[model samples]
Target: MNTFRAARFALRAKPTASFLGRRTYADAAGPSDKIRLSLTMPHQAIFKGTDVVQVNIPAETGDMGVLANHVPSVEQLRPGLVEIIEEAGSTRQYFVSGGFAVVQPNSQLSVNAVEAYTLDEFSIEAARAQLAESQKIASGQGSEADIAEAKIEVEVLESLIAALK
Candidate 1:
């Protein structure tokens, strides 16, 4: 009977001793330290499990900046710029045609976009011309589906133009 009691006490005490040395949330590493990022599109993978210091995404809820240890969330991205701050402190920007941004619990950010491209890859003149054409169709007496498609194009083009500026 005494041996059974001693064994129980030892097991309970061992757990308490380990728990006492455990670090609290406040004592843990900073959230802005670093995070793994994977930015992908249909045609190419922009970032393949790369470590980045920060990432600013244009989510439907609002523009949000994510860092290491960010709260896990699945956000609907808007057609706008996705800025990635690399480990070397250089910032790279890409215009995404709307998709999703997923922040995992394990300090990982995955952004899957319908289309993404650098600003220099776009021509301002071409965008402006397309914008004009889209606006004309959107406001014209076209079919409902055609008008809706034109409106969507207008929105995306406007975002792209804003990012290029």
Candidate 2:
């Protein structure tokens, strides 16, 4: 049997056994329940299989909060802030360029982004200068591709600036 089929069979055979090798029952979720979050970039793994209380993501559809037992869905992320509420009641925010967020059936959220940085890591002056340059290039007589790229940069910079505020 294929690996996927075998896994499916195993899951069916054991309703309480999740794909993450954890056992979960169909019980009413509570605030104490934790969701495993995996936030990854190309070169870094921000939160790898870490349990958290909640996560607020900036999806293309809209901003949504994910908690344990959230309905399974995939969301395309936009350039904005991702707020993670840790188990200890502390919140951390990161600015992600763009990516996808997947809420799995097993109380897990996986976020893959092109780029991500903490709010403190950004320099307002530098971002403002870059935004100005990108705006100029987007309005200038550059190639269509260059103009399009600059426009995307402008969008990201604007979002980053807003997040920094």
Candidate 3:
């Protein structure tokens, strides 16, 4: 009896477009629509369920621009820039070290990053100095672990410099 009930529940039909309260993907992602976006990091939540016109992310596979009602998927982000266009047509740019972004069924995008900061917050001089130091360490005769760490730092600084441009 329990098994039969479980099977029946599993086979239940999904509401169709004609259902009075059902909303289709096309209806939700109509032109000029916005999606809810949440960009979070370990220490801060940049945008918390804020409605935005669009978001551009640097995914491992490739760069992608997300709009409302995009097919649900998970993308691994690379160290690069994330651009957000707000409802009022203002744009903001952030540098994310790396992260995971998930697009949900109801037009919600959640990004979890290890570290992120607005472009304006970064100083070009500081980044250049760091990049130079990292390059020296990476190219010098250092321990394998130190060299590896410096190499990672170099990659991150290069990405930051590109984003600053």
Q: Is candidate 1 or candidate 3 better by TM-score?
A: 1
- For residues 1-165, could you state the per-residue lDDT of candidate 3 as single tens digits? 685454323322221233223232445532426678999998899999999977889888778777765556799999999999999999998899998999887778898899889988999999999999999999999999999999999998998998888
Local error of candidate 2 at residue 158 (angstroms): 0.4
Best by lDDT: 2
**Predicted candidate 2 versus true structure: per-residue lDDT over 8-106, tens digit per residue:** 344333123254333333334433378889999999999999999778899897787776765567989999999999988999999998999998877
> TM-scores of all models?
0.80, 0.80, 0.79
Separate clash counts for every candidate: 0, 0, 0
Model 3 poorest 10 in a row by lDDT: 11-20
The C-alpha lDDT values of all candidates are 0.81, 0.82, 0.80
Q: Across residues 1-165, which tens digit of lDDT does each residue of candidate 1 receive? A: 685555334322313333333321233433436778999998899999888887889989778777665556799999999999888889999999999999876778899998999899999999999999999999999999999999999999998998888
Structure candidate 2, residue pairs in collision: none
Ranking, TM-score, top scorer first = 1, 2, 3
Better of 1 and 3 by lDDT: 1
Superposed Cα deviation of residue 46, candidate 1 (Å): 1.1
